[model samples]
Target: MTERLRRALDARPRLTRWLLAGPGAVAAALLFAMAMPIWLPKGAAGIDNIVFPLILVPLIWAVVFVYACVEESLLRCVAVICGTAAVCGLTAAMAFTGWI
Candidate 1:
């Protein structure tokens, strides 16, 4: 079963890579941005957290996308992207639940 799944994924490398570089990167970036507010310190007017995440979103996306595209190992790329998204998502969720 695992061999078959591996073969199937290997059959269409471009499609897999595109999927990772596109939607996967976007999701990771968004999750990271969402969690940023929880850790970022407020400035004088108390809006730095919001504004900093907004400004960094595009850069984060680009960095993730590039890493996904350029990485030699597809599995590693997936792991990194998913791990980042999961961590950030958990952070945001914990914050929302008042656990942080």
Candidate 2:
């Protein structure tokens, strides 16, 4: 039973592998982007208000492209973190400028 279960587990699609090493990261990024607005607080006072649309979106896309070509999961993680940062930074700048 354990052997069968292990095999089954192995057969299952791994999100980490897909996210970390496969082209699935691109798909994940797209899904994350599409779902971001829904999961994020659109009316929030910080990152949500600023980064979601511009810098973060482009950053995610760039990461997806770059990470898709490489096997490094760290780059993908960087993409996620940096994407958020880019968004937050842009948001802060925009808010400070009263563009929001």
Candidate 3:
């Protein structure tokens, strides 16, 4: 890894990094699952009743974009919002599917 990357990784404890990264990773996984129907082969079991938060993506992006336009802080609000939204969306989807 580059020195900068290594330093960034080493600055945070393993557990802290995992906790910080977990939500985004889970969101990415859920997003991928939501997109799987496009790749599933014919005659395979199909996805049903998916409650995708497609609207949330744009809404969050707009919020972030607006914040970016005026904010000077180095905070990572975009990741926070996206991660939280992902968790909420996934949980809602699961409940809607009777999986929760």
Highest lDDT among the candidates is held by which one? 1
Q: Write the per-residue lDDT of candidate 3 for residues 1-100, one digit (tens) a residue.
A: 4555445645654543444345444455455445433333434333233323333444544444454344332234334445555765676677568776
Model 2 TM-score, all chains together: 0.34
TM-score: model 3 vs. ground truth: 0.35
TM-score of each candidate structure, all chains considered together: 0.82, 0.34, 0.35
Q: What C-alpha lDDT do the candidate models reach, one value each?
A: 0.90, 0.53, 0.47
Candidate 1 structure lDDT: 0.90
Q: Is candidate 1 or candidate 3 better by TM-score?
A: 1
Per-residue alpha-carbon lDDT of candidate 1 for residues 1-100, written as tens digits (9 for 90 to 100): 6566557667888898998899999999999999999889989999999999999999999999999889987767767898999999999999989999
Mark the 10 consecutive residues where model 1 has the least summed lDDT.
Answer: 1-10
Q: Which candidate achieves the best TM-score against the true structure?
A: 1
Go through the candidates in order and give the C-alpha RMSD of each one to the true structure.
2.6, 10.9, 11.5
Tens digits of per-residue lDDT for model 2, 22-84: 444454455546546444676646667345754476677677656544534444454564465
Model 3, residue 74: distance off in Å is 22
Collision pairs in model 3: none
